[model samples]
Target: MFRNNNLSVCWRLVRREFRFHKGRNLMAVLSVALTMALFTVLSVIIQSLVGSVRDYCIHDMHATEEMYRQFLVSQLPELFPYFLSFIPVFVCGFLIIYNIFRIGVDADIRFYGKLITLGMTPRQVRVIWYGLALAVCGLGIPAGAALGIGGAVVFEHEILNFSKIPIGMIVSLKAIAAAGVLSLLTVFVSSFRPARITAGISPALAVRYMELSGFERKKEKNKFFPISIGTGNQVGEDDRKKRITPRRMAVYHLARSKRRTAVVIASLSLAFILLSCVYVQYISADHDIYLHFITFSDYTLSVEGAGADGANISRDLEPSLIRQVEALPGVSRKGALYKQEEWLDLGEHVYSRLTNYFESEGGWRLREMESDVYWTKAYENMRKNHTCIGMVYGIDSSYTELLARPEQLIDGTFDAELFAFGAYAIAEGVEGGGGQPNYQVGEQVEIGGRTFEIMALSIAPAYLRADNDSAESAFSLGLFIPEKSFRQLYPQRGIRELHLNVEEEERARVDRWLADYQNTKDPFLDIRSREALKETFDQQIRSGAAVGALMALTFGVIGIFNLANTLIAGLLSRSQEFAACLKLGMSDRQLLYMMIWEGVCEIGLVLAVVYPLALLAAGPGMYLYLTKVSNLWAYQYRFSIWPLLICTPIMLVAAAGIPFLCYRIIKRQSDTSMDPERPGAWS
Candidate 1:
């Protein structure tokens, strides 16, 4: 009978709390609902895409048997790791809900104290808060599930249309069930601390617990001006007469509540950081893609034939076909190069000696060693019997000129002297370091019993055929020698590739000509156009940007929700203070202005923290992407501030709008309660 009475009393308290704090409760419910909806929608979309990819790979018209086998054996096994990405979303949702409830419970500490004084047990208090939480979840989860299903259907339709996949939405019942469970868990976990605080508070202390403090008050006397003042003695006597402003009062309140201030700033800053990082990623990717295509020739023509090498094609082109291509009406200029596989006779002792020099000499000067006549002679004598195989390119002045611009050279010049003096140039085969021969300009190296001077050191362009999987290139340690010397050494090797430039208006004609030529005269020739490559890159950019935008939006929503909750809690907590200011002759308009100032100050603080950190983090990532992914030698890191600039005004408006709206609602309720015309107005 006592337990039943306790339960009845707790239920009555819960109903009363809900009735009086309807707005706050509603906001709390919406916050949970929104988080759940976002999680469910994201999960549904991911599952749909995974299913679609699996189906498309299995039944795709273009997929080879080997590709299908590889997807099944390798890719499908790796799908479990992708679920780990959802952990952050779950954590952020928990934090949001926890923060909202903690603020609410803290504001209502006195109310709980009152209940405790009314003979309610601590257990009853726990039941009241827990029951309220469960009730909110019961309403939120189902609504979220419905919205998630609708979102999934829309997403599936778009994805299928874009990918041309003939698959229906594979809604995962298991995933939906998991989402519901996670939502309930989040609510319970978030409410646990608040419930404990409420249940544990002593009735006497709770009733008198007026404010939170970061530090205990000290008795020390200091000549410090209060934040509430508009001006101080520091600014002289005349300035001290200035009126106390609402803005000053807001700043004072913010200063007093350091913990709350920090939490609000952190929440807002984190979202801004995420947004800025996304912008950085998008810009970096777009820049890298552009750099990749620009590093190659505008148009390329090549031939392949069966050979002893793994290549089912020989490293030779037909002279007649080259002549015909060069004579085409739309052709502006042409260049050719002969690529051949060869062996480098680096003596067995050479690798060991270089390794020793790299470790012990404090620095490696092997490039200078090649130029030193004495060292070259020593190396030649020591390595006479050792040989390592690599690819070598034989090019004329025209071919060198047709490569990427001269600025792409990392250390040396691309001059006519390279071919004129029968010299070779070395390019680093790997990114960061290593790969290239330790040879510098004016150096001479003997290959196949003939010595050639080193005229340049450069970054390898994308057009040069090299191993893609490894850091070191098959040609990095090899050579780029003049065609004359190349022909003398390997007389049988002919031109295997040619690059051509065509007038802008005549690109279509040239494309048509090449297509016809490949169809009839030489089916072995492969041709690619710059226009087609650009289109492919554009498509990739659009799809990637779309996905990035969606992720940013999700994080942005969480942040905005957090800001709104913080503003409402902060404003409501200071209701008595605002009421006191009104009694002290401060107008309602001034109070509204104070709220706006507070919002703007929060946004400004967030920007100050987020921008610099985001840029600093983005720098190294952008550098690595340029060097490794794009193989760019002359790439410049660009900081995109446009995202910050564009988002600032929007954030400012949201910050100001949320507080003003909350203040208006609270003020109206206060007015209605104080009216003499209303029944039980005093009560």
Candidate 2:
């Protein structure tokens, strides 16, 4: 009977406290709801995409039903990595929610103390607080889940029209349930410490505790600076004055509660960092995609014979047709590239040496080499090692100039004249064995029975192919000789690629002319303009940017919410101090200005920590991406500062405005209780 009475009292106290602080309670609920909504929506979208990809791969890419089944079985382990990535998001959400709840509890410590004095047990107090938390989560999680489903639907609609494969909005009941459960768990865990703290508050201390000023005074430390005898007294005096301004005092308030300050800073700065990193990643990926797939030309017209793989059968462009196109009104430049697949003999000794090297390096130790088949397959195996097969391109000096620039060259120089005179240029091989290839500049190598000297080593272009037989394969081991030398070596070889430069305004007319030419002269030719190629990938770029923007906006909102809570909590904790200031002849306007300065100082400090930390975190990711893609294509890292620049002012305004608004509200509620004539008011 006594326990029941205590429970009733605790419930009444909880209800009264919540009713009095409705705004604060609502903000707490909103913060949790928004975070859950973002997590759910992103999860739904990811699952839908994975399903779409699986379906497409099975129906369109797989050659047989058996292959599709096997592929599905093999992909079971991939889900683990996806689950692992969510751990950080979950941790961040927990921290944000925990900090908010802790602040809320601390703000109302005196109220809890009053309940304790009214004969409520600490256990009953904990139950009341935890129960209130559960009620808030009950309202917030379901609403958040609904919002997530709606977001997923919108995302699906945006992508469906652009996708080649059919896609539909898929809402997984299991996923929704998991999200709600996770959110509830987060709330419960976050409330645990705060509830305990509230329960332990002493009645006597809580009733007398007006503000954090006493604690701040106890913890404050003074620093001494050394000065020369001649410059002694005045040196430290100026520094002391500078440090004692209103702005510095505001900063000191923040510094007084180190843990709260750190939490708020981390929450806001993490969101900023994530947004910046996503934008940077999108820019880098977009640049790489364009560089790899698009050739260095305003337009390309590929000629081929009728075959299943059109590239397998090369066809020549008639000289008369080329002349006619060049003479047309808009042509600025024209060049032809002849592509031929040829096998070069690297000699028996070189083949044996390479095979021995691979064996010594344990390249094939995992595979079983049957003794019976080894002797039978010796000639064929040796021929595979001795033969280097690649697409040999014939280009003129102008085309060489259109390739990678001088800085891309690892050694020697991009001497187009030398290349035109039968000297060959090798691309720095893909990363393997060592940083560079065994061969170097000025080395002589025989190609098609003719000797050629290596002119330069450049970063590999995307067009080169690697020989699978060699353990250490060079991406740019293929030949690039002058067109004159190419013709002399193989008189029957025909032009396979035609590159042209046209005026921007005349591109459409040129495209139309090319279509007419293809219809009349050679139906096997494929023509592509730079604009058309870019348009083909337009949806991909839009999707990337949209995803980044959505993530930024979602996390950004949560961060701002956290900042507001911090400012409100800080101000409420120091209400007594502000009242003391007012009684000491500090005008309301002055107090408001000081609060605004505090807000500014908080955001300024957060930015100072966030920018460098974000840069440090993003640097390695950028490096790895650049190195991997650089091997396949030429690309440079571009720093994306626009997102950061745009977000800065928004954060500053939010930081300053939140505190100022909270102060206004508190003033209107008569919480400061200023008395100018009271004794000790000036003190």
Candidate 3:
């Protein structure tokens, strides 16, 4: 008898099944390809970025093996965000691959049972399903590798070029191979559960399982309803109304495949959770942007031509415009720094302060310091003109915070209230010996006939007056006085610098207002926003925020694809169920309503699941991740909830609309409203 030897026939039959379910198979292939692509891209991020950092950024180029290991350990935190990108891709891969084979096994349970009745063994059935997955992987890996690597090249090129990073694109053949192997391995592992499910189902169990598949013909008392597959007169009419309503029937449908429905919801939730992570870690981080070069606030307005014809150019940056800018609704905080470069006659003060630094050290600190040229210059200026050069920087209360960096506060505090009360801050630590006078906190320094207590001394770089000319290495003694006091001293210098923060939503509006003013009113105003400067600074890392966006987009697309595949395949496989529902007098409108309810339930479940999961990631998980990295030193646990505002609507629309669109397509394509391949499914 052929019963024990018909293995070839079963192989051919499953091959036919794959062709028959080509849409599902195609989705399987796409998922595999995308997973492979994500993996390949991750490999590139590691090899290219890590290698570039190791080669270029490492302090110890001639490092020992142990040192190299330490370097890698140190960089892992920096690499975490790139790793986060692949998580959603992996989730989508798992759910889609697992769902594809699970649905296959359940749908073809009776077919496999028939095959077993003829000759096939459990081992053969398992091999057949595994082989089908292998076939999908075989088509997917190469395509995915090419796409992933190529995309990384394009993206990294733009990133590196904009960031001015001197790293070239690196395409590792090994990474591609590994990606392919991993994808193949994932398919192999993901195929196992469904294979086991198919192999373990005995013929009797397969016959009984048909009723649970949502397509079993109703056991009607009236055999007249032969086409009924989704509903039942097997129960009383009252029972149908009370128990077997479409709502309950949908719940039963989902309850029967609870694990599968969970997989779908979990897949959807992972995308949102990752997006929220991006929001918390990347968006918040971007908002907390620090630019060492950005002086005080969001935008600074100074006269570009003030360096040349300062008084005349300063006149162009009018008091009227300052008032207009201050009155601008978007401008949150504004302040002015009125400067007066003066040569005060500090004859005795100059002689003492200039010699103080050299006298403290046993020897000259600098080669220039050893010379009496500075001494001669200072004494001669005092003796001849009875004057020494100095700068008076006028600041409002807002600039006190900028003047006192933690490391640069050599002594005293930058208390704003104290500053407003006639206290002055002095910049100390001269580059080549002549800087702020040796003045203790509470000591008085004279400026334009006003005596003020030195409340603080800061060596802040902004106060350093750094110049490219090596000869001009020394910083002059500069004192910061309150804006009102300085205006009383130098009223002609209207405002040297104006710094202010603009509301983020109103930045563009303010920018437009400034642009118009600059074009028509003051071309030499020299407006600089922290926006452009921060963009350049972010370009230095090519923006982790940008990487976060790519992650959200990639995951969103994959999530959409998975949802589409699951909903469409799940619906298409159950044509007989819809026919049965129609025969049971469930109208098309009612069917759509039930399906819509299913989608709503899925979205609701996703929302219910994603909140805690995201919170868990944002709370302790974010804390842990943040503590491990040096680059993210400034990052705090401010989890942005804006991703919900974006993903929720997209998910709601997808969940509600996918089923409607799929059913409409199915109906419009078929005049009889039955699958062409499954006869008597409707009639």
Best by TM-score: 2
Best by lDDT: 3
Candidate 1 regions with alpha-carbon error over 4 angstroms: 1-95, 114-192, 213-257, 277-296, 303-325, 341-392, 400-459, 466-481, 484-494, 511-527, 531-553, 572-591, 594-635, 667-683
| Ranking according to lDDT, highest score first | 3, 2, 1
What is candidate 1's CA lDDT for residue 210? 52
Candidate 3 has its poorest 10 consecutive residues by lDDT at 466-475
User: TM-scores of all models?
Assistant: 0.63, 0.66, 0.60
TM-score quality measure for candidate 1: 0.63
lDDT of 2 by residue, 571-620 (tens): 87677777766664555776788899998988888888887876765566
Q: Write down the lDDT of every candidate, Cα atoms only.
A: 0.63, 0.65, 0.66
Alpha-carbon deviation at 70 in model 3, angstroms: 5.2
Q: What is the lDDT of residue 74 in candidate 1?
A: 49
How far in Å is the alpha carbon of 227 misplaced in model 1?
A: 16
Q: In model 3, state the lDDT of residue 345.
A: 54
Q: State the lDDT at 126 in candidate 1.
A: 90
Off by over 4 Å in 2: 1-20, 41-88, 110-134, 142-185, 199-217, 220-256, 275-294, 303-327, 339-431, 434-460, 463-494, 514-526, 532-553, 572-586, 611-649, 671-683
